[model samples]
Target: MLAPKRSWIQQVVYLIGMYGQFLKVYVKTLVEYRADTLIAVIAGIVAQGSTLIFLTVIFNRIPTLAGWDFYELVFMFGLAATGRALNQTFFNAPFLLTGYIRNGRMDMMMVRPVGVLFQAIGYSQELNGVGQLITGFAIMGYSASHLDMAWTFLSVLYVGIALLCSAFIQFSILLTISVLTFWIQEVRSLIYPITWLYDFTRYPLQIFHPLLRGLLTYIIPYSLASFYPAAYLLRPEQYGWAVWGVPAAAMVIVMMAYFIWSQGLKRYSSVAG
Candidate 1:
């Protein structure tokens, strides 16, 4: 068949750009609720700080994880935490799938000209993500500085790519879970599992056996989201294999998730008003 025109790709880019406008509107609305946003930021700081303290406790007790020393582990934690936090900050719309479907808000969004997937993500920014982002950056910076290893320009580049890949991978998984709403009337039950899976993405899979680790890398792909990339960055000699797989898998998953979501759109039956 003749290839479709370049129009489709352009439309997708246009859709993303439009979301930038919506982001501005979202920021305005958020600013209107200054107290709530402020409280959320402060609370997020405390919660995130507690998490770091817990990690410190664990690492202090354990000598090394999968032969990765403290600095290396910290690097892994930093990269994945930063990536996950950024994902939460930006593409948080998928989390609201339950309420949207239950209220038939899905029907209303489908009538719009823009991509409904993008539409579902409200134009407003997630202020709370900012706190997490700050925390993640702090940890990453601290870890990088304390390490005996020197990072060349290429290493820095790799870190940035790894971070982006991990975030995209996690978002793809979340997208896949949110689409499950169309299959089941209510899938709020799925949210806990989703969060649990995401939280589990922070560490090296080597903690588990080969078979179970394979399940994570293949079945749920938490490895692509965090574990593998973190390993590659932390212990390059040991996890050189995942340097490619981590980023490559994330890209592939994002594409596949997009395809799956498009399929779900076809199954959408607008609730008759």
Candidate 2:
């Protein structure tokens, strides 16, 4: 007889337990490479900081870009950074699936009792995420203090929901692209272009030409990751509907990614005999 299906809560608890074990293992490994972890975190901070400095220089030359002031732009950048940091921290290992596939490591994961995607995601940890997390929240805090929006319990709750949706969207995109390795077997270079697209999300969507704006919003939907949510937060009456799209788009992308990933698994061929 077939086993009973697990409830949603049971599934969530199982995932949490799996991730907790993964974290324990990751921490143990990280302790062995403390210097490397420190350097990685520092590098992340410097990289993100340089972007902020570049924005500062640009704002100094012009009061606003596409009608968004420095603080508003910072808020957008922070939202993108926070989403990216969450993906890099917890879901980035899937991007390395190409290496695993090429080396037959993926076969080992398939033989394990746990879910393959879960194992793949928990395969590694990134210390650089700590720096991005710090930088993202610092800019967000500074922007929040300066912005005219009224702070309320509901507003804070909205921010949390938006961030979660944004992070899911980012993770789904990364996973969908990474799953290409199941067929191509060498897609390491493809990740750069996908990540480069995210750079466009650091500014208001209005800055882009109409065609480019449409492409970002419809084709890749990068705008949903940060722009729409930031817009909603900055001016709820004006952009409240856009914020609702964030979770909707996130759900669609995640479902699509899962479909692709599941199909890709069927196409996977072991490199080992």
Q: Give a tens-digit lDDT track for model 1, residues 1-273.
A: 232355878977776678778887767766898887777667666866787787788888998877777777776777777887878877776787667777788888877766678777653247777667777888888888888666889878888888888777777888888888778776667865865776666666667788867777788787677777776666688779876777678778999999989988788886774
Clashes of 2: 0
Model 2 lDDT per residue over 1-273, tens place:
233478889878988998999899877866888897788778877887898899999988999998889999888899889878877877777677787887888888888766788888887567778678777888899888898989899888888888888777877887888888877856768877887798898888887899989988887787898889989988889898965677888899989989999999999877775
Q: On a 0 to 1 TM-score scale, where does candidate 1 land against the true structure?
A: 0.86
lDDT of 1: 0.75
What TM-score against the true fold does each predicted structure earn? Answer: 0.86, 0.91
lDDT of each: 0.75, 0.82
**Model 2 alpha-carbon drift over 4 Å, by segment:** 1-8, 29-32
Best by TM-score: 2
